[model samples]
Target: MRIIQLFQVALVLMLLALSNEGRVNGERGDRQCEFNPSLSPRPHSVSILEFGAVGDGKTLNTIAFQNAIFYLKSFSDKGGAQLYVPPGTWLTESFNLTSHLTLFLEKGAVIIGSQ
Candidate 1:
């Protein structure tokens, strides 16, 4: 009985030591892989208003949209480009998207298709 109790205690202690070591190693690995925003290339953002997009829900902004996308395409080599539509109603026709372009719409922003 004495031998059995000692063996069980030894086994439990070994498991505890191994688990603690694994946890320490896991924490160290996580620290090594931590995210650093400055090390990564940041995408460029441009608001539709900068391209003369009038979001009054009445003005047709087809040309503005086209110009904005064309301008954003210029920055495709530097990470990517993001087109931001601010919070307002934007009336425009259909527009095409270029490669490496992201369209971000803020809350309460609406795009109405006009005939």
Candidate 2:
């Protein structure tokens, strides 16, 4: 009787496994994978210096940073924007970020926060 019960359990497990496989295969057949270029954001780069940010390591650049971020927000629809920090010691305060904006820092670029 114990051997018969084990055989029945094994058969049920096999059926469940087969049913799951069939469901997964059917779903994959319904949808095909493809790449869409429009789905990706277009790349745009802007320098902090354009916004009057001085990286002298002493000047307060809070307003400069704010202006740069605001400018980038305007291009949020055109594939977003990228703020590039060149090789300099930028000193600024906290700032907010918009969607689809990328902050890129080059080598030797340092951002110092003012307390």
Candidate 3:
């Protein structure tokens, strides 16, 4: 009887797992500027700008970040490229927004603009 109960529980768990859905990064029920060249921004470049002075937020590699900004600015369209920062505490050191790009901050979002 115990063995049968355990088997039933395991079967239920398996079914639950099978029914669960999976989501991709920046591609769930989200709306934001996407990195598509056909779009306005034209995939000029990718930039990572942190918002907090000191925190565990992902840091944009100094040089690469600048280059990304420069690239984005240089070819900044009226509306095109997308800046995506996942949900969490993002400590930005500096943020330079370009034209035509939409900044998407997910829910439970914490964006600390440099004050």
Candidate 4:
């Protein structure tokens, strides 16, 4: 009976130690993959408003987003570009995004999908 109890305690301790080891390794891995967008700034920046986007939550801005992306695609060879979304409720439909572009949203900015 004594041997059985000791064996059960040992098994529990082993499992706890293994779980702690995995948790510590996961924490370290996450730190390495962390990204801060503010740290890396885009070369060129343009606002969605420049493309005639009205962010009143009722306005459909799908074309504005599409046009903005199409215009920004030209700067891809220069150094990439950024599409800045100001604080407001922007209703838009699905649109294609280009490569080497950063879609930066300001604080309080919300994007609502319009199907």
Q: What ranking of all candidate models by TM-score puts the best one first?
A: 4, 1, 2, 3
- Which stretches in model 3 have alpha-carbon errors above 4 Å? 1-67
Local distance difference test scores for all models = 0.85, 0.82, 0.53, 0.90
Candidate 1 global TM-score:
0.62
Q: In candidate 4, which residue pairs get closer than 3 Å at backbone N, Cα or C atoms, i.e. clash?
A: none
Tens digit per residue, CA lDDT, model 3, 1-115: 9999999999999987665545345345455546645534345334344422222456433343345455556555534555554566654546566666655555555765433
**Candidate 4 lDDT (Cα, 0 to 1):** 0.90
Which regions of candidate 4 fall more than 4 Å away from where they truly are? Answer: 1-38
Worst 10 residues of 3 by lDDT: 46-55
Could you tell which candidate, 1 or 2, scores higher by TM-score?
1
Instruction: Report the lDDT tens digits of candidate 2 across residue range 1-115.
Output: 9999999999999998877773565563454336534534347768998988888899888898888889888888888988888988988888887888888777788999988
Query: Of 2 and 3, which scores higher on TM-score?
Result: 2
For model 1, how does the per-residue alpha-carbon lDDT over 1-115 read when each residue is reduced to its tens digit?
9999999999999998877773664564334435545533337988999989998999999999999999999998988888899999999999999988878778789999987
TM-score head-to-head 3 vs 4, winner = 4
Stretches off by above 4 angstroms in model 1 are 1-42
Q: Can you write out model 4's per-residue Cα lDDT over 18-94, one digit (the tens) per residue? A: 77773565564334435654557779999999999998999999999999999999999998999999999999999
Better of 1 and 2 by lDDT: 1
Q: What is the lDDT of residue 52 in candidate 1?
A: 91
